[model samples]
Target: MVSIDEVARAAGVSTATVSRALSGRGQVSAGTRSRVLDTAAALGYVVSAPASSLASGRARNIGVLLPVVDRWYFSTVLAGIASGLQSAGYDITLYALTEDPTERAVVFETFLRRRRVDGVIAIAMSLDTAEADRLAALGMPVVALGAEHRQLPSLAVDDIAVAKLATAHLTDLGHRELAHIGILHDVDDGTEREHIPSLRRRGFEQALDAAGIPRTSARHEHGDFTIEGGHAAAMRLLTGDAPPTAIFAASDEMAFGALIAARDLGLSVPGELSVVGVDGHELSGFFGLTTVDQFPHDQGLRAAREVLAALDEPAPPTTPETGPAGLDPLPFDLVVRTSTRPPRRES
Candidate 1:
């Protein structure tokens, strides 16, 4: 491998001058910096990360905390973070926190304190007061995605708005009796309940209430936010004596399941059962499912930008919010498709 010293020699500059030019850290004349850069590019010279870190007192690596990596939303958001951070010249290290409290304690208390990363970006993981305190004590920049922390900066899609938009789409199609497939709010895993699901469920209810729909006509069923879970929940709703004219699922995956359930029961979509969902999943277009698009990938991009900004500005800028930064709300839109329409009158 070509060394920086070789590039410095080729550029007729000192090693220190080459280092300053390459790292963009110290004072180097514009002409010398440009010449050194050109020589380094020609020589394929690369700086060692450890050496750079030692010199700058920055690891130049970001730790990303995730609850799980298997889901579509999580994976897409991660992809965005990886791409953004890579372009910004930073390495990424993933820290998956399980539901096990013991393991979480080890990660937050031990691993994170090792000075391995300059900052952190947490995705959809609930942090307790103690955990938040520990992160704050790290004195590293922290950004959150898809969840909230009173002490950290965050970027997330408004789940309630997503649900309300989905519900409103069906209602606008002239569907009176509506059913919702969402995650059960009361589920306990020895931590705080997920705020997204509860807010979505409330949004669904609020839309119905605003429409002046009777409480008895507003049907609801809990799902695991998976296709299978949605299928099961949808089966129950579709098989009822007085089935709803339309259904609003909390996620596109669940909406797909509801569509499958409707098909199995020989119900013609838009004629008997109109289905709508949140998240503009890739499969939504194939299935022609109407939905509210909450760009998860974009959320990741914004979250990465926020963390990078915090890292650059180390001192927390004075914001009107209580946290180091405020919540950035992503935009959502109702995408109309073939799966939703006015309910057909019984012949």
Candidate 2:
């Protein structure tokens, strides 16, 4: 690797000048900075991360916290984040957290304190008062995605409204007997309020109530936001007595499963049962499923931009609502497709 000393000599400037020009930290004449940059590029003199950190007191790294890595939504968001952060010349340290209390304690109290990261981006994780306190104590910019957090700035969709829009679509299509997959029963994913399924369930129930359909009358089955889970849950719903005319699944994956179950039971989609789901999964169009498109990749990009702005980095600035107490509502839309239509009139 070429050293900074060689580049400084070639550029006819001091190493301090080269450092300032590359780091963008101190004042240097434009002509000198340009020359130093050209020379550094020519010599392939990349600054050492440790040396730069020691000098600037910055890690130039962001830590990402995730609950599950195997899921489609989480993976897509992570891809967007990685692209944005890497483009900004920053490295990322991924932190995979589990449900174990001891492990979480170590992360917030011990691992984070090691100063390995300059800031944190938490994706869809519920934080208790204690966890929130520990994060605040870190004195680093923290941004969360797909969550409603009081202590941290978040980029989240109004899930309740999103669900209402989806449910209303079915009701407007003249479907009354509707089944909801992915909500209803008591589930413990740390905090129900912060959990996506619980919030969506609230919206689903609210929409049913507004349609003059008693929440009690509506059919429901629980799916764990996976295709397999959706398949099993949907199979049960379809096999039961007086099966619903339409089903509103909380996720596109579940909706896919519902479609499969409908096929297995020899039911024609839209002719007998229509289905709708959440998340603008890539496979949604292929499956011809009407869904609410939440744009998970865009969410990730916005999240990374928010974190960079918080760190006062030279990234594209977001709106004023990115303050510590702000809750920036992300965008979502309902996409109509072949899987959803008015139920056929009963003969």
Candidate 3:
């Protein structure tokens, strides 16, 4: 009996394409589909299943694991993933994961082992050794975003550097008194290196220290990465004695909240208060807030494409797990707007 891989190689396409072409369940150009048909007939290849199920050697679907569904950044990334997968004639099976040990194990051991998906894409949800072992055992492609996994490929932004850039912007503008708004420990991959909020905070402090400023002289507050949380944090910072001249929010939502807090306090932006944030949120320009644009949606698309491209390649033999290569860095940039400027002279 000939294998699906043989037919795919002879047809000059991926097994997924062969499955799609044979099952007529996914997008395939008429010419390519015809060619696949001719090649299969010539090779005496026969379809084991009609609807491209696991028996067909391709599921025409991918599993997407996410840490959160409600947040803007996550939602945006999910949309991009969905868009990329759909355009490629594939569907997605969504899984929302948590810290629950049993639940996590069920996903990796049971649900995924069922093999309904051709591959897996995990966004902002890190997998540990056991979990990575289980996934690796599945013999399918896996891609991670935001959260990095040592055993598998990952794409993530340099959070520490992103934060450093945001903070450095404020410092470069001659703003000495700085405040940072973001709660620590939002998400921790097994490495602890990808812990989002904590990394940003470390970046903030690093930037301050580099500027010959005492770390203790700067203010730190928990913003929960939300508008309300940011507003409350900023309110406390702005209302207190000797408030900061600049605020660097870990996220754009929090930065918007800071902007609101400044307005409510009757502080003139770029004069009495300057605020910057990470994440190039849609409203960043509308609010005139400077930010680091990490391109979350593009990040999602890239992750999706990584898994898809992997599908078209032959499976590599199992090898020893590579040690601590570190997470792959995604691109980011500092987007300056009207929200920041050198503080006006008191004289």
| Candidate maximizing TM-score | 1
Q: What digit string (tens of lDDT, one per residue) describes model 3 on residues 1-347?
A: 77788988998999989878877768999998999989988988866543346445777789988877899999999888998998876889988888898988888878998878989988887667667767666788888788666666778898999999999999989989999999855554454344788889999999998898899999998888899999999999999989999999999999999999999989999889999999999899999999999999999899888888888873455554563334458999999899999988798
Residue 220's lDDT in candidate 3:
91
TM-score of each: 0.93, 0.93, 0.83
What's the count of clashing pairs in each model shown?
0, 0, 0
Scored by lDDT, the top model is: 2
lDDT of 2 by residue, 124-204 (tens): 987775676577668788887898666666779999998999999999999899989985675554452557787888898
Which ranges of candidate 2 are over 4 A from the true structure?
29-32, 186-194, 313-323
TM-score of 3: 0.83
lDDT value, candidate 3, whole model: 0.86
RMSD to native, candidate 3: 6.4
lDDT of each: 0.85, 0.86, 0.86
Clashes of 3: 0
The residue-by-residue lDDT of candidate 1 on 1-347, one tens digit each, is 99878997899999999888888888999999999988988888888999889888888899999989988878998998988898878899999999788999999989999999999999988787678667777878888788776766667777877888888877777789899998765555433335788889889888888777775678999988889999999999999878889999988999999999999999999788899988888889999999898887887788888778887777554332455656658788898999999998777
Candidate 1 lDDT score at position 95? 92
